[model samples]
Target: MRWSETCLSEQLGIDPGKELQQLYLRILRQDPALTLDPPVLATEPAAVKHNLPAQVTSFNGRDWEMIEVREMITEHRLVTLVGGGGVGKSRLAVEVAQNVLDDFPDGVWLVELPPLVQPGITAQSLAKALSLGEHPIVPLEEVIEDRLKRKKRS
Candidate 1:
């Protein structure tokens, strides 16, 4: 069935421009299975750490009990700074992310999926927010991997 459609489209002499449209179609059909070689990730080293925002106030000993948590975040590759409401966890994450934004040359991106009420659609909301319109048909993991790789590069 697909072969016939391709043949028909070919025989019709309907050329949607041999350059741009063909390239666009190639983009639409890009897949590892279709092509022997796939695109490679950027090999640039990580960016240097940048200075944090001056607006961030330092944590007082008694004020932020999450000092250990903050230290863990600073030390670990990935830290989940979790806490109760109004417990300064978000504030801490913002500060930490700001402090290390330069280290992540891609930049500190805060994806606020507040309007995304459904957990199932969180990825879609994030993709839209990030302006990553490609690969909508692919799984969320693939989208995230692609975005993270691109972010790491630039």
Candidate 2:
């Protein structure tokens, strides 16, 4: 479900893109009063489990900081790393994921949500990121968790 289909926009005739930009800023401000009509995304646990790959980087102190963060991710942890736009959070995450992709024998997945507006679309993005079968109806997170559980069991 895209944000365009939400009642808030249809009833109020609001442009969701602008609203999301506003909401993103509001979230950055840590504004407690900011209310989302459909409610903003609920934090979800990181799906990372088991061994991680060695991160080998030539960066200096700042790069080291990002590596430290990537190393510190705990099980079921929901980490929201806030930094200036274009400050390389995505880059760091990708670097870490690439380094550790080999640890996940099933496969490593990178889900990009920048284009997503509706909260429901997150799971879809996850499913797509993992390259699941076309038009699967199961929720993305559930499918991911199920696969991880199977891997752990094995």
Candidate 3:
């Protein structure tokens, strides 16, 4: 823990819970975040819900493309960016995902498909990407689908 977090926690009379709140935070992600200051925590437990990578480099141009992609994603549930490698497809996807993070209360999730070559294991790959390591007795796809279904109902 950072000195700022500890010092501020003590100064504000905060007593952290046993076993830590983070142990079950992914399920706790919802509307109206309740995280305390410093306004932005570097490794906040609420943030653990999303696996989206941070934007490292400065992004420029593609205003029209960004708008189109954003509109498509908003209007349609399944939006795929079809482009060749090195054509900024991934960047556009990340930008759109980041922009729409608040729209999905459950969490904004991204599955990197580059490492996957076999279609047969795509579900398994996605489960791995989601870090859903529940006992194999409960099918991962069922868990993933059930989660999305519940989100859709809300």
- Give the whole-model CA lDDT for all candidates, comma-separated: 0.57, 0.57, 0.68
lDDT of 1 by residue, 49-122 (tens): 43234554675444354556546644543455445667766566666566556566656554434544677576
Q: Show where candidate 1 strays beyond 4 Å.
A: 1-58, 61-80, 113-117
RMSD of 2: 21.9
Candidate that beats the other on TM-score, 1 or 2, i.e. the better one: 2
Q: Which ten-residue region of model 2 has the weakest summed lDDT?
A: 73-82
RMSD of each: 14.4, 21.9, 15.4
Residue lDDT tens for model 2, 13-103:
7656777777767887979797546856678776654233355655344667666765654342223455777886666666665665555
Inter-residue clash pairs, candidate 1: none
How close to the true structure is residue 86 of candidate 3, measured as C-alpha lDDT?
Answer: 85
Top candidate by TM-score: 3
Task: Give the Å shift of residue 34 in candidate 3.
Answer: 32
Tens-digit lDDT track of model 3 for 1-154: 3454586588986755544545335336742455445666567466454677889998899989999988886675446677677898888888888888777776666765664467637676566766666565877778766655555301
Assess candidate 2 and give its lDDT.
0.57
Candidate 1 has a TM-score of 0.44
Better of 1 and 2 by lDDT: 2
Ranking by lDDT: 3, 2, 1
